[model samples]
Target: MPLQKTLLALEALDSAYVNGESVKQLFGAYPRVTVDVMTVQGEKGSTDFVKVVVPGSEGKRSGGQAPTMGIVGRLGGIGARPSRIGLVSDADGAVAAIAAALKLADMQTKGDTMKGDVIVTTHICPDAPTLPHEPVDFMDSPVDILQMNEHEVLPEMEAILSIDTTKGNRVINHKGIAISPTVKEGYILRVSEDLLRIMEMTTGQLPVTFPVTMQDITPYGNDLYHINSILQPAVATHAPVVGVAVTAQSAVPGCGTGASHEVDIASAVRFAVETAKEFTAGICSFYNESEYDRILGLYGSMRVLQTAGAQTTPAV
Candidate 1:
């Protein structure tokens, strides 16, 4: 069901010259869906940051009262290029995010519009560099984490689902998709039952979840060992962030070609789309307001964790 859109996005990204304009054209047919692309320059190179908005009938973009939900496709790059031949494993997050955006656009045309606007953000880079890591190599982005957060983590987003390829690690051995616990203001909260339920319905199997450590939620460039950049958005926003990881049983390098699986990526797409439906309708919540308030009152603000610690190097 979601494959049609997923494959469409894959075809769009599996190119040597893919850019913001090329991706923006995908939504030109839909009058309600608005797509925006900005080309940003970084140290290594540049990448196109793309945002697609699927407006809901009562969404705030139209001056309505409904909340806005954000879906960020977090990845370093779609391809390692010359060093790699084709679409690499890191590309799955972007594919799934774009596919979800396309599906939402199609749904709006067919009278399936949601109650609130859905904003999806992701960057496209055909050829990105690779960084050495412990278990495997990572798909290094053209921009640093700060640049990525600045473009992708919009303040308008009330809640965010960060989708990324989390395969280049020893943890999360499942071959399908996995979700991380709700992370907010440097606190790693319990897994959302609502999200788990949606995952079960979408995947038709038990919900799979990955672990998040204190260091994982902190900003990168601290010289700490993070699982990956899957939860990097958490460090940039006060909004509750959840990571939707495209995983594998083995430690697969992010730069490894021929490792992307369409079906598994589709599974993540389904989960995100369903969560958007429920989240906007007031039927699903990422974190409990009262519980979070209680924790905050008892422990004070944990927002310091959002910043680079004292005497740390400038954020790369």
Candidate 2:
């Protein structure tokens, strides 16, 4: 089947699975509760970026309890190239079908791109169950509670500060999460609502505008969630042939259990896509010398297929 057709079919399957009265009612009342698929073109050597901050006094006290080591503070960020494929759905069944179709398409078009046969999949979920029942809040920035110590410094404000050197001088590591001056809490909520609306639509829907400004963290915590949104590719295959590649943005920290499941799924997809892209690139490079024009011809043919509606797999 054509790639577009396959996607439509998968979407139909998802709709059917979610069509029960209970699900319909739930969706009608709270459409944001649904799951959505987001896909990106598979690429090789993709990685998940993590930034950490440890806490300690800036001045080294000659006599004090030795500073504690080990990940005092850790934060994750998403890392991905500009090109990718994705789908979104609240229905687990639609997600499954979309995943299957993506897997099949990757299998069929393995060598078409620089990434080998790979389909990167990611699912966004909430960070904590106790905070809210909404699943789409995965993209939201929660109000951080400030806990101060005797010195008035946030006691466990471990999210922003890290200590590197312990012996003489304390090396404080500070990474900023950029916040937009114009965007307010209300604006953020509206963006989330817009995303929910898009999620209810078809599979290939792309966000008209990305609300998050910078991909990197800034001086404040505003960009924390944005940085964490980086997506990595996951690799899944049978035997010698890679089956699926999953990729997604970085996940939030200290979220509840339900949100963790979504993080795992997204991580798995990122790994798959990265693996496939790397493997394919290596294979193509190795064989290019012998095949020469022939390899180029194959690539051209695949491009045409992709353009002509063939279910082209991702490039390895």
Candidate 3:
């Protein structure tokens, strides 16, 4: 199957699950595992080519004493240019699909062996800006704008984990990740200190200063928009994981865009389960001794499951 078709199938499968349909009912006609690639037009400049118009003429002048003239001036084009790329599948097909999309989006990847387990981490710097430029007392720079990108790494990590958590919820928790309440419409999710701390602990990477290039004007008067751009990939990644964590700022535009981001938590959880099943099947195809042994060890401990249950159980 083509990658686009595979993605469409996965998306359809997700939709079916959301609509209260079973996985068998949705994917019964499709092959068990498939790999495909999709190309998306990424960021592009204005598409509308400049059209020159003459200064004096609004309409065609017939038999004019002078020369033919119809207001001539440079005007911005009608459409915007976009980025394009090929994406590959990684682990399970769904994971592959999710990973492919993230990779296409230019997200960064890092992995390390921790306690003999390979922990893969993906990161992306999201653009977010605070409006009205609140001043930091005693600061010389634009404090609000400065703070916006100062913790870029943190939000990127959150987005990565949010994707991971959402995917995990689909497989394990059977719940959709909740959006953080701090975000509002038009504004993208911002990195918080807590998220940064988590990433530092997980990857054992030293804290680096955030870059300055990512700052941008807030789209709406009060809210930012770059975080919203990542919603699709975030949800896509979460589709295969057990659970996802989303900040309140990630906005899902209306249905007109042909993309759906607003998903019911319960339905998202179910989709994650089905997605996990597909992922497991894909992973099984290329299994190795180490991978098998690790998976076995991970699942072998009933104590772990029980402990997890206990941890999540509400206190009586």
Candidate 4:
């Protein structure tokens, strides 16, 4: 089960001094897995961007043609530092991502390799800023959204699963996990059937989905309200992006301490690992390419939404 790894990741990350190198120790035993960590400085602060790659037998690293799947732990920070102690609610995203990578690495060591490469990217920051929001506060990142996309979203990724703590809003009230509709090139596509099937099998219940608005898919700093940063990756890549939300029944502030639930985080990790397995094996698809093409043919590209539009004049 994913519980062991999930708990292990929680312990590893729920600290006042956790860094990338400390996290790298978890994968040291696995020879096949590669972990890269970089310290990037931002105006507000600095954080470590950690990338873990569990390569498949036929992945591009070995000159194979199978597609690459990306898992992005989308979060502002694992902890709010001086303002807050220990891991906060927003840390669920990073914990889930790290746990998934650890589980995949372990599976590979046991001779269970994938058909395509799986790249997991997330930042490590014990201290991050918090932002004021409607229902609750949000954990602001050390870097802006653009830098996050540049570091986490890669071209090699044909599809992406963005995992984030979406509990700071009243939009969705599920207590475990939820998925979003497929979003690509600024268009909010339909819920992916393949993903739904996987979620049902994993959760043993009806698949839970959250709403995605035009503003949510648009880049941050657009002077608009966003449910959360869960789908912000959609603004950065042409690849189809889906959000795997670790949620709550009530609005929990992203910066709230002692709000992280290990069981819920483990569930998200399980879904992420399963999706990575099936997606890389070519058994799952994110969207219907032909249908997307047909819609694009009728309506022009919505890519303009990916950028900050021209400012309208202030009302008199």
TM-score for each model: 0.98, 0.21, 0.19, 0.98
RMSD of each: 2.4, 24.2, 25.2, 1.0
* Residue-wise C-alpha lDDT for candidate 4, range 129-194, written one tens digit per residue: 999998899999899999999999988899999999999888898899999999999899999999
What lDDT would each prediction earn against the true structure? 0.93, 0.22, 0.22, 0.94
The better candidate by lDDT, 3 or 4, is 4
> Model 3: what TM-score?
0.19
Model 4, CA-based lDDT: 0.94
Candidate 1, which ten residues in sequence have the lowest lDDT sum?
307-316
Q: Mind giving the per-residue lDDT tens digits that candidate 3 earns over 1-316?
A: 1234334433542321121122223322323212221111223211111111111111122222221111010001101111101111100222222332222221111221011101112211111111122211010111222222222112211112222212211112222233221121112233333433433443345322111111121221133322222122222221111113321222221111122223322222222222222222232111133643565566552222111123244579
After superposition, candidate 1 runs with Cα above 4 Å error: 312-316
Worst 10 residues of 3 by lDDT: 70-79
lDDT, candidate 1, 168-228, per-residue tens: 8887889999999999998999999999999999999999999999999999988889999
Candidate 1 global TM-score: 0.98
Prediction 2 TM-score vs. true:
0.21
Give the number of the best model, judged by lDDT.
4
